[model samples]
Target: MSNSQQSLGDYGIDIESNPESQDRQDPHTIGILGSADDYAPHSIDREGLPNINGFDWEVQPVQYGPAEILEYWRLDGDFHDGLSHEKIPGSGGIIIRGADDYLREHALTEIEVPDYYTRFENEETHCRWSADGRTHISWRFLKRAVRLSNGYGRIDPVTTRVILCDTGHLFVSGPRGAFLVDIPPGRIFRNGDDLPEPPDSVYETIRGIQVPEENPELRTAFERYFRLLSESPYPSPISHAGFNGADHVLETTSEKTVVNDNNLKVLGGQTKPFEDTVGVYSRQCESTNFVVSVDPMHLPGEIGEEVTLSDDITSFGSSGDTTGIITGYRTNWREEDHIAPSSSGVSTLHFNLIVGLIMPDLTVTRRRINVATFEP
Candidate 1:
């Protein structure tokens, strides 16, 4: 009998010497078997099966060759594609680029990735995947290194510029341009009181000041001045001089004038010469003399009430202060002869007040004045 026909009495099985029979029985075999002339010495049964245990196997029919088998196992489902340096989300870790490029982009120096392998002494395996395959990387090392390199926990100093606008608006200028923000009006105190309204011209001038990023000092100073103006109720006068590196000077002038009715005649004399002239000219005489017609009803006292013109006349000035007095007064009547027979030929009464003044002897001198009633 051929070797294929051999019988195993212990195992109650027949041995097959044919290669095809051996191949067919390979799936059923689990342990080492006796060597045969057709089988290679290094060859083993179940060569294609998985080495792991407790795996569920499913057999599906296939018409081509041997039945196809599929093996299934449990997986965590957390695996994902590796991330590129630029594709990493969020800010913190240094980007994967040259030092110069990184510095230029972030305005800071390059920071190295953490080396957890060298830092930790534990037996735990820490690794990451690279383009080629799995690689070793310590997240803890990288996080610490990045934190240190980036100054992650420290507070960075920031420079800001504050500007006060004349429109009662407060502007804050920083890395960004001046931002008009609504600031509480009373919150800004100057000289222990609320700030006053700034002139519109001041706003226009400040807006004209060029604040380029290159000149930080000048920009900062401008901002500081703005803040000072906003906070103080009475800030030091701000002018073009301050911006031009000169001392700030304050100039104030009267806004209104007060005039006494008694001074009307005096004002008429001083202003009479200029009534016809177009251009400005100085008076040649020390005192001006002029005649004024007065209404009977406007006279300070009753008719026939003998009163001094100087006592009845009060000086009027633009600043609400009396500046001069009425010097003289008289009354005259002239009769009109009408040729018309229907006319009654009534006489017209004229009351004239003559005003005279001596220079450098005035009791009250005013910077400005207005006359309410005067006719010359």
Candidate 2:
């Protein structure tokens, strides 16, 4: 437990190549770069599993420090262009970091998107289809660390270079993407740590999704992360009802759907601490909130049923001055929605519901709740 820290390469992978030296003595062992005394050796319960690598990966908590931007590359037309650390206007990476104030202070702020890229629609500009549309876009990946705090003061940070692009939204990939929100400089917390409440810079939700009214499990889970009222006017996407089955309860159409469906289930409302982009965190309200796209055609339900509502739904409504519901739906045709022609036909008609969700000290969260495809 008191072993001295070992030297590891830039990304924490040991790059030692001397095969005959003690450095490679444990051929199957992977080393982490930090004082071994800082963490307990994370053991894997491999009782029924075969030894694939002959060793399991260990958890080593790296020292907490200020965020740093080591390099940047120009992801030009389709990104085949080559890599350069030289700063180019209009283009910047996302910043994923710990929710801690110290790390947030040290993280990089926003960089504008180049006029050429920004002028073009986000859908057209963000993809990797260069001239011929058949070439593989090159990427100069770098490992960046995401900081995590136990809320009580213990801090741990981990590194990642992976991003998952689903349908159209971008996610941090791996465990990091699990509990993300559009809050600038996304905040991640260790399990059981009291998560910070919203309206702060860290607790926004995916725009269009709302809490399920009948799902005690989901509403209970959502309330863990957001503040909701019993008498609120807005409606929740019904999931499951007890005996008299509810219709059009928000359900995933398929088991294979990735981002939206899976995002619905954050374990115990716990999120792994990390941020998404590569620089100091900045809340690009347009970009971050703009990315999440819910499918309009195959809206989730038990089968082929549209949502049931006796009243006409607007973008928002008022039950009273202090309380009402807010749905995650937004105009499918925002100015930036110029990528594909099919997108023009997607549903965008739902009430904002947030205007009425006013609470005295608690910030109202527009929880991501999937609604039926609107046909006008």
Candidate 3:
């Protein structure tokens, strides 16, 4: 092998088709189309390289207009003895005479996600964000895989891949951890009430979407509500009658409080401990009556900070299409009385919704942080 070439067999990836970035065209990537040509060998120097015809190769251009190149990986090999290569067009069409130079780069190691990269927004086209590249892939890919593969995305760390979760989440060693960056019906909790209809984003009443029908627990867990999603949504089955069903959104019994920081002193009033139902549900809402606490607040008030009922949401019913519980879940973001670092007195209400039956509750927990404000 010349200094420009490597043992292609050593690397398990094939250049003809990149399973990750091949064929599929997203708004950011239209698709990949590469080609190569014959470059006859000349007089051999002791190591059999070039005597002339200087081998050069590039990725053929496909009307991408102009691009701000981020990052790219290259592969090099010969089917028999010809040449192959790829490139980022400065403007358009790629130019390759042989395969030697292409082999000099991009044929090894897995990608560990660079700190900066771009990703397209889930709902909008032509809109991209400059963020930790990992955040972009982590967010959209999961939703994409889940939507495409029957509502779930698989992450295999061993293979450094996040796939749709049909074949048992793929790889034995799942890829890096995945996060829930966003969720649908995002604004519904502002009022804390279940609507007779889901938001337009939800699009329609969910008919029997592709959820599993075998597992008794998972089946019973979904059936009714999802079936109704095919019809319409409801606060409680008894609260209204309609088409399409609803996705599961549960009520939590966690401590939530309204705090304000006029960019100065953190101000908030505290209620008696565990006073969740006093005047929460009936208070006020622009759209809905509740907000969800991913992790409700629980703090040892030595720092003039406390957790109270930010809002109260109840479930409707208990049987058939009606979940029996009146209402559940929320999304209230009143300024924090005080925000702390993850080291001392943190005020974040981490809410975790464990998909369950009857009372899909949002469990709130807090981490001890040491955050404080500054002054002149």
Candidate 4:
């Protein structure tokens, strides 16, 4: 068989030797042309290829989805080897990209945190403070995600370093900068014996006077009196009254009245008797007396009369002879004594007396005096 005829098997077709079978089976067959001009091939041009017809072949600009966008900005040649970002599921238009670079440049260092304290995952838009409680860091991207998915996209943990101020407070570092965190106070355990005792000087002891119970009424009265006296700016006198008194005369006489008569008896003549009075004894007498009495049925008028010294005297007749005038008088009764009969049922009366006395020279002298009396 000729080479072209043997290649028919390669094309998966066999030519029939019978002309009638060929006509029946190969109905669409075209007859060979007698000349090359009768059958011409289509032209093959390079207009659509690079550097063909003066055209410069280059990669076309294309839009990327959320995941591919992250890879593009990552700048890593290996697209699958770096950190990636994606939109949170049902987050609407929010997107985050290039978080790995942001955290690597700005986040707090793992060495700065103690092993006891946990370091949170470096997810986009998330932040954490160092264990030393000084540096603050966070990261996020503004680009919207082209694809929707739950949570942050697959992110690889990145090592970060931060220089923090020794403020003794929690802080985080991020692209924006470091900021303070208000950490809440933590509870601490303690033992009952660990409590401290108060100083002895802080405690005080008070001692009170023990009063006898036998005379409670007297004690109460005294206490009331003392309290009233302390509160009063000027305490009133216990008793005040007015009265008058009679003044008495004093006289002096010679010791010898008839001594000369005996010495002249021998002279047979009676000697003149010697009688001499040095001064006259005539003087105005004034006297005053104060009397206080307690009577259960005592009338108010009686008390008033007694204090004023207006009580009638037997010597002073019904016409009433006034020997002396009263200047002032005051009376005080112990109410407590009346209320509590066990107490002293005593009333006080004071009398002030003004008296006129005649001296040896016959000059009238006036004297004023005061007296107080109590009765029960």
Best by lDDT: 1
lDDT of 3 at 174: 17
Residue 321, candidate 3: Cα error in Å is 22
1-376 per-residue lDDT for model 1 (tens digits): 1222333323222223332321111211311112111111121223433232222223421211111112223222354234222111121111111212211221101112223324332322121111111111223333322322223233111312222222222222222111222212211111211111212212223334322111122233344333332333222223322111011212112121221222222332332121222222222111433333334433433311223333334332232322222222222222234457896754332222232221112211222111122221
Residue lDDT tens for model 4, 1-376: 1112211233222322222221111211212112211111111122421121111222321211211011012122355454343321111111123223222222221213211112322221111111121111221111111011112223212211222112221222222112222222121112211111212221112112121111122223223322322333322113111101101111212111110111111111211111111112221212323344432222122100112123342111223323221112122322112446685644433332232222122222223233223332
Candidate 4 segments exceeding 4 Å error: 1-165, 175-177, 190-376
State in Å the error of residue 278, model 2.
38
lDDT of 2 by residue, 270-309 (tens): 2211111111212233333333333333221211112232
Clashes of each: 15, 28, 64, 22
Quick one: ranking by lDDT, best first? 1, 2, 3, 4
Return whichever of 3 and 4 wins on TM-score: 3
The count of residue-pair clashes in candidate 4 stands at 22
User: Global lDDT of each model?
Assistant: 0.24, 0.22, 0.22, 0.21
**Model 3 misplaced stretches (Cα beyond 4 Å):** 1-116, 122-160, 164-218, 222-376
Give, for candidate 3, the lowest lDDT window spanning 10 residues: 126-135
TM-score: the better of candidates 2 and 3:
2
